[model samples]
Target: MNFERAIIIREKTRLEQLIERFNSKAQAKFYIERSGGDFNFYEIENEKFYESLNEVQKSISKHLKLKIIYRSFLPTYIFTENDLIVVLGQDGLVANTAKYVNGFPILGVNPDTERYDGILLKHTPSDMNNLIKEVVKGVFETKKVTMAKAELNDGQTLLAFNDFYIGADSHISSRYEIEFKGKKEKQSSSGIIVSTGAGSTGWLSSIFNMSHNIYGFNTIGENEHQSQINWEDEKLIFVVREPFLSKVTQTDIGFGVITKRQTLKIESNMPRKGIIFSDGIESDFLNFNSGSKVEIGIAEEKANLII
Candidate 1:
């Protein structure tokens, strides 16, 4: 292969996580059983995922230089520009890895087709040879996935591949002042979800689904897939989940589109437990307390996924 190395990113399987917590497979099973969970399903899922991973590893070994990495180490890991990234897991794994890799050409490989409906994972292990051949010849097709950037006035920033959740860390309401397109409001809701085209089908889509599925909701002339934006779409959408209407708070500026020109600005009124987490990674979140301001917009950096 022309590339120096391919970084195969993966997540810890359910079984692995269970074993890590309990220290042994038998202990994990016992714990699951005691907790009224299905241990058999866990064992089967782990076995299938490992088997698929083995097949993928064997196929990728012949054509490319590969470096295997777990998802947990991604934040501290340094990725070179010349390296090719291959994430061997479900769509969430692909989204998690995309934010860290900058613009490296990432190939998403589905380890178990039956287990995961990986919309982001476009290739199977059997297709590895052709995919590698095209990449080495510099003839690969790429999707420039749009990403959402959350920047604090303090200079801290985080990129979201699927979407961004800006709100409270607890069950209580998130308090914030949201301004967009010269319109502003004091909102207290569950949170604000800023979604990119790439993320529309992810956490973003579920929001629409939940709203659309409401008994009397009507999406009359709108194409249902309109919320499922293309990967390269330049625009972004933000929704304030469950905005509470009261004397002090207004829902007028609750939802809108964030484009290349205009942006969404949020001022946090929460004293603590306020966070901005991307793609559902709760641990890797930014603290958004009182006096914190975040600007949400289209990120300059895009994810290049080899299709």
Candidate 2:
């Protein structure tokens, strides 16, 4: 499909440069501001930032076919079919980025390059116009990123772009009775992390004390795999880091797999108090006493990123 319309998502600092860049190239129809309400720090206050973006939107609209839209807080609108979505924010905008632009190939423009991790975004604002041109012209490659889907026993379903963690919220260690396919096993560790290939370099790598290979976890050499479990049953592979212990020391940490299973269930000892999140956003709270079960596996659909 030909993407005629482009959605520009940007913060206040990069507004002028982004406008100039967009105007010089593609004809953007919608200007979406990276409002600071969803962010944790460095927020541009409601009065100042909105007013600034509003004026800039008007100025850009005068020259090109652009309509400036703003939400007093974070926006909840999903992208229209075949719309090109761009995100401009630091780490705090990760969840929102994943939520709004799931199926679409999202291009992230890092406004704050020094502080940002640049996990989702591959480039900065200065290089965005060329990237967008490449994307619209079908000259760029895309990576298929897998996502995790979780279903609680109460019939609640959630999705994670990174990993799903099950463990104690309190200082006390929590035990989990885990079942893979039909076989059952017990884990007495502080928690268990079910991570996606994209998340392997983040939380999973940290827990395992390994370096992240951005291409994917499959590229890791066999020698490295000996220390970690890199086997794949299908699209989903299970890796357990420092399992069966409340506290782990480098000398005692070991990794294993829960076997190749299409469906896996985890019953937490402290069910009601357990937490389930996707890419750091909490989706639902586990109600253990009422027989809560968190099922983890590959999502039916995958995420596509514009690289």
In model 2, which range of ten residues has the least summed lDDT?
24-33
lDDT of 2 by residue, 19-137 (tens): 46568312221333243223222233323434434543343333234322322132456566566665555543543455446567766555555666787777665565456556667
Give the TM-score of each candidate. Answer: 0.94, 0.64
In terms of TM-score, how similar is model 1 to the real structure? 0.94
Instruction: Report lDDT (CA) for all predictions.
Output: 0.87, 0.55
lDDT of 1 by residue, 1-307 (tens): 2587778899889899989999999999998999999999988888888877777777667777788899999998999876888899989888889889877888999888888897899998878877777777788888888998999999999999989999999899999999999988899999999998878877878888777777335644467435776778898999999999999999998778898899999999999999999988898789999999999999999998888
Which residue window of length 10 is worst by lDDT in model 1?
215-224
Candidate 2: clashing pairs of residues: 271-288, 272-288
Over 4 Å off, model 2: 8-75, 91-96, 137-139, 210-261, 283-290
